[model samples]
Target chain A: MNISSHRRTRDRVVTVLTYAAMVFVLLLPFALFVGLAVKSDLLFREHSLGDLLFSSVWRPSSGEFGFKPFIVGSVYVTLLAMLISCPICLLSAIHITQYAPTRVAKVVTTAIDILAGIPSVVYGVWGMVGVVPFVGKIAGWCGIQSNGYSILAGGIVLSIMVVPFILNILMEIYRTIPRELTEVSLSLGATRWETIRDVLNRKALPGILAAFGFGFARAFGETMAVLMVVGNVVKIPEGLFDPGYPLPALIANSFGELGSIPEIESALMFAALILLVVVLIFNATLRWLIIKAERY
Target chain B: MESNMNQGKEGRNIERPFAEGESIIRVDGLNLHAGKTHILKNINVEIPKNKLTVILGPSGCGKTTLLKCMNRLTDLTPDIKVSGNIYIGEQPVFGSKTDIVALRRKMGLLSQRPFPLPMNIYNNIAYGLKLRGKYTRAELNELVEYYLRQVNLWDEVKDRLRSPAVRLSIGQQQRLCLARGLAVNPDIILADEPTSALDPVSSEAIEKQFAALSKDYTLVMVTHVLRQARRIADYVIFMYLGEVIEMRPAQEFFDDPREEQTKKYLAGAFN
Candidate 1:
């Protein structure tokens, strides 16, 4: 082969090797998680397949199985996180996008960046000392059960943490709109608020909605902070203040409970599966919204 | 035109500028300064009623500034000072305590380039009406259709009134803007280089529409396009360096050009 063709072959070989390395990197954890989910033994040493998924006795000593309650608790907490975060994040995004002056937006946006950079563990600890008791008081006033480590507490803190992320992304979207459009509205005799509401908000709706979804996903898949704030009780939450077990928390909490290898793997694999699905759905929806926004 | 001119009995003759019922808009000793920059200096001209008056000048000649000042659009800016008065049909336009909104509603302003709002065709046409708080649902539909038809845009947009106004071609968007300006039902139309963005065919269409509109409404157009002015102007006001050098009937100004600047400008030797 000529030197040029030989070089092309080298480039092709490098490309294949790079892809193979990436696949090798990705496949390890994926296979581990999937294998743990399907493994029969709570301890993976002897048997490969087990019916731990359908069993009810979560006691690993007795070789009992099933994580139905844990799954329900995870879904409940994640959904609650969305309900709490979506509106607050979207409102702040609109405020920053439509109302905040340039300097104020810059300063406030930088503050949100700082917020995102704070450790999730710090949020968890802060919630333990700062947020749980306040939630308990609110729940007491509302005549709910007197537990502060409730799903509601976790969701609220998670919502606050994810708001900055959404606001930052959405500010960029608003900035992308042409200044001439706003000028046209003003020249038409529309007031500033009217211009924002009728023109800017409507134009930025899809991007704002995407921001909402992103905040929701971030709050939903959170682990350390949510686990700290969310009560690690093994039951479904009856209300905001009720004790609950999110999936990540269950994996974390139940790992110690498992005496055998199978039980630990089962919990980790189940939690990973749930999170992957949620993340995919969240991103897919956001992508669809971006496309829709561009078309209009 | 014959009745308006009078000759003085002297070795040196005198010329009269005004005619009976001809001074539709009169600006006297107008001076405008923005901070330290004096944009206009003693601008005085009486625009003829029911005529298509064209204001011609080079860039930064205060032609657009004067058009803006005609209806308080200039007042939308702050830190500006203006001396003297402007009268529209005997009413002082920028008079103290003038209702700014009311003043603007009576005049239509078409910007240099098309700016179609982020709305559908029907909504774009009805935007002004909605702001003015007039019309029921049926009435709004009727008014939108009427104005769109008047601007020759109804047939093309009737099927897609829900599509965004931005999707329209630039020429169509310009006409949509015209329709929007007309829907407000103003007495005078002010066009600031309205055809500069359009092709010759579109420019001709807009010129023809302006001619038709002049029968019902007064028009003051600011244009750099000499051919366009020569094609349709009834009255011509030439401004150089922020002052009106000459104002005359279109035939008199173009055929028998007088002031040195006007002569030079018309000859394409200078703007």
Candidate 2:
């Protein structure tokens, strides 16, 4: 009886510790949001939210701060990266899971894991050396003047960086589907490609969307690689060849000089808050979608 | 008993006559190896057209493996070597020039568990039909209804055609899978323990459907249940440890066994 009581006491303590850990994790994002909001209150009090968001001017000396260009840059570069990455990732994942031999698929997945583990700064360096020049050549062929560092260059690099993330999720989705489903389709006269296109792809659609959401969030908040190739020009880009500055780039570039300038710290804090909120919203929506998909 | 069984294995050629009806599928000297383990050893059998041919054996005896080889479904397994000649009608199964898709289209398969395509009930039936050729919406509707009725599922599902196929009970899902397979218009139907995952009622329903379907399609089934085999199998092929122990008409094989293994199996000596 005494030993059983002691064991019960230990179990209760462990349960309490687990709940405490979960609560701490659950509150971290809320704490970060509140801290950011409080710091940005100085800028919010001076400028209306709409003016701060929509105005295009960014003269810190005269106290004119606008986030429209950076917002557009983040959206444009992230969308460009997704457009470049989605089809390649989807097809590669299908091939690896459905067609490639076991040994070959294992090798390919290992390569993807290494790619995922590479440092972001290394990707930035590679982008400067390779992607910028390729984009410059493409711009020249298209009769546009570009100095190699532009949104297109950033997009190419960012797309390559997120390929592993998207492909990993897609491959996992395909693998979870029962082997029986594939055989049933095959025995019904469907080719391998037909089975993937009709049955497997349809089943994995929600997971594909969730993968794109994750890739989008990763590309949107990427700091070093996008900052390196995007040229960090504070203007709304007219086209793929034009220079632009995303929100993360703006905060990274100006964070060191924050105390010397009045209200600048608040503005940067506001930018961080915006990035956090957008990523949170996207992730929440994807979670809701996955749950709904599973229900049916 | 062991020596008698060895003699039965040695004298396989003289024990049973070839299937009396027109043979739809013939396997000659079929051998399969997965990695280093030999899964099927020198199988020779014939499936009669428009008959219920049940491959009976204990678990892990390659009954399902032999059934899968008929439709070339075994090709999906990795690191497996299949060296054999299988003929369906006049077409060689593994011939270099054979169209695998077309060959598979001629054979429908029912797995141990129901696997409905991830789609609405209507689309699940329509999927195979769409693969074959373009059909008008009216024609697709009529054909889907006809196949569903063939499995006796039309009345139960007529009102919920647009609902997801997975919403049905386990029994209904198996029937839906049957309808989906039949939609491809296969001449041969292969079932690998199709009722193993079902309750007794559902198993009975599926058995009734199989019995009815045998009048039109050449049905090959794998089952370990002796009672079920006795009830449904017009022809029987008994396998043990990757070898065909006996092949004969179901009545004769059950009533008068030629081999000690067959007699022992019939008397419930061992699974």
Candidate 3:
């Protein structure tokens, strides 16, 4: 074959392969979800989507299924985790970029990157052993009646796990801000903190929001660390100290036990759907915020 | 080398070699080093109050560095050490007791390219005013308009004061930066090649503004363009290779140069 013909064939093959891979990667989870939902619907033909979604009970052995408690658990745990992590990550990012000396910043960033590289299971074990007791003590001091394994413990562990992710992204965003902009503010007699508040924060607001989106998504869908500490109880948690079951934790904890129970299996699939939808909605909102900021 | 002709022309030209005025900024034996490299050497010059003093030199000649030193802007650079006595009025600028922020507030700086704060046109001007003190809504609006008018930007930006400053043309942005600097009520305006990023027409506009502004505020401008120096300078400081080579009046510096380096630079022998 001539050179041009060979090149054309090679390009066509690569393009076809790439498109196939893209479609498979994008649709695999969706296809699985549809299959699971249909199978569950057929098995439990009597139950409506409302009963599967809005009902509270989720017993598997006798074939009861409801996902509301898991949904609430996911929302509350993720919200608490984000509340704990966002400010700490943001302030640490600022401190690294603005206040810390070069050596100190480098050391802090290296430690954060190492923390980010650790496996999620390792985080789970660490939380199970270390954070549970500490949180129990804090709860005792606060006059809450509980052991360490609760929503608060889950949130505390999740916040610690997601902090490095958010901090790294935020630090990168802050670093990309042109040095000239800050210099101009400082030259105008603005203090370091004022420069950060007025100039750097304003410039990086959209990116910071995106970082929060990533942190929230990770915290929401996290399974291993949350499963270890969250006291996997399928109930609407009354307070931070109450034991709860997030969607991922519920799915993981029930998948093995629900082998003979079709209705509970379908309920688990619905829980997965909720998690997927929540992530999609959050990412979409973040994209909209960034676009709005760029428009101005 | 001193020009012998200066003696003859001293009586003829009232503003002979250097314009006479109260010296607002006096740099006494300023020397600066960044790491091991000497950035500025034995710089001594008095910037006359209410006059346009242009520091003219090619790139790497320390002209811009010298301009920054007067306002203590060089302190921001790491691994840099400076030994000098810079006095703004009676206050020593480099004294350990000096408040750097307050010192910087007394001087407004315009860089080679304009960097308007990431805000709307109105906020760009109002930022400095708001920093200094509190002002009600009507007062802020009035002052923002006042500075905008001072830079000949009021009419163009009047309708779009709420829009982002980055949307303006480069020339307009430069003028807006000038207005922002002026709004702070600084005693001196320090510019480092402020017009090099601008087109000829915009450069002319900024030069015109500087000419007008010199009657009230002491202006220190740095430029590599010899023609611009001749055009806008009331007093001239010619630096070469980290040293001040010639300090003279604008006309006198062009008409007759004392140092061979200044003569060569003026003749465009080398940039």
Kindly report which residue stretches of model 1 are placed more than 4 angstroms away from their true locations once superposed: A1-101, A145-147, A186-189, A251-260, A286-295, B1-113, B134-137, B188-192, B218-226, B229-271
DockQ of each: 0.22, 0.66, 0.51
Instruction: For residues B105-171, write the lDDT of model 1, one tens digit per residue.
Output: 6677787788777677778888888876768999999999999999898899999998988899888
Candidates in descending TM-score order: 2, 3, 1
Model 2 docking category: medium
Interface RMSD for each candidate model? 3.4, 1.5, 1.7
What's the CA error at residue A251 for candidate 2, in Å?
0.9
- Per-residue lDDT value at A177 in model 3: 85
Q: Weakest 10 consecutive residues, lDDT, candidate 3 chain B?
A: B5-14
Estimate TM-scores for all models: 0.71, 0.94, 0.89
Which candidate tops TM-score?
2
- What tens digits encode model 3's per-residue C-alpha lDDT throughout A1-296? 46798899999999999999999999986886677567566435866778877889876666667778888898888999999999999999998887776788889999998999999999989998998888889889999988989999999899999999999999999989887777678778898789999988998898899999999999999999999998988789999889998999887887897745656666677677778878988899899998777533
Expressed as tens digits, the lDDT of each residue in B1-271 for candidate 3 is: 1233122222221122443347788776678998899988877677889999999888999988888888787665666798866778778878789888888888998999988888999999999999888999999999999999999999999999999999999999999999999999999999989999999999999999999999999999999888888888999988889987878888988898888998888788434
Q: Which residue runs of candidate 2 sit more than 4 Å off their true CA positions?
A: A1-3, A259-262, A291-296, B1-21, B268-271
For model 1, the local distance difference test gives 0.75
Can you give the lDDT of residue B74 in candidate 1? 63
Where does model 3 exceed 4 Å of error?
A1-45, B1-21, B269-271
In model 2 chain A, the worst 10-residue window by lDDT is: A287-296
**Which predicted model would earn the best lDDT?**
2
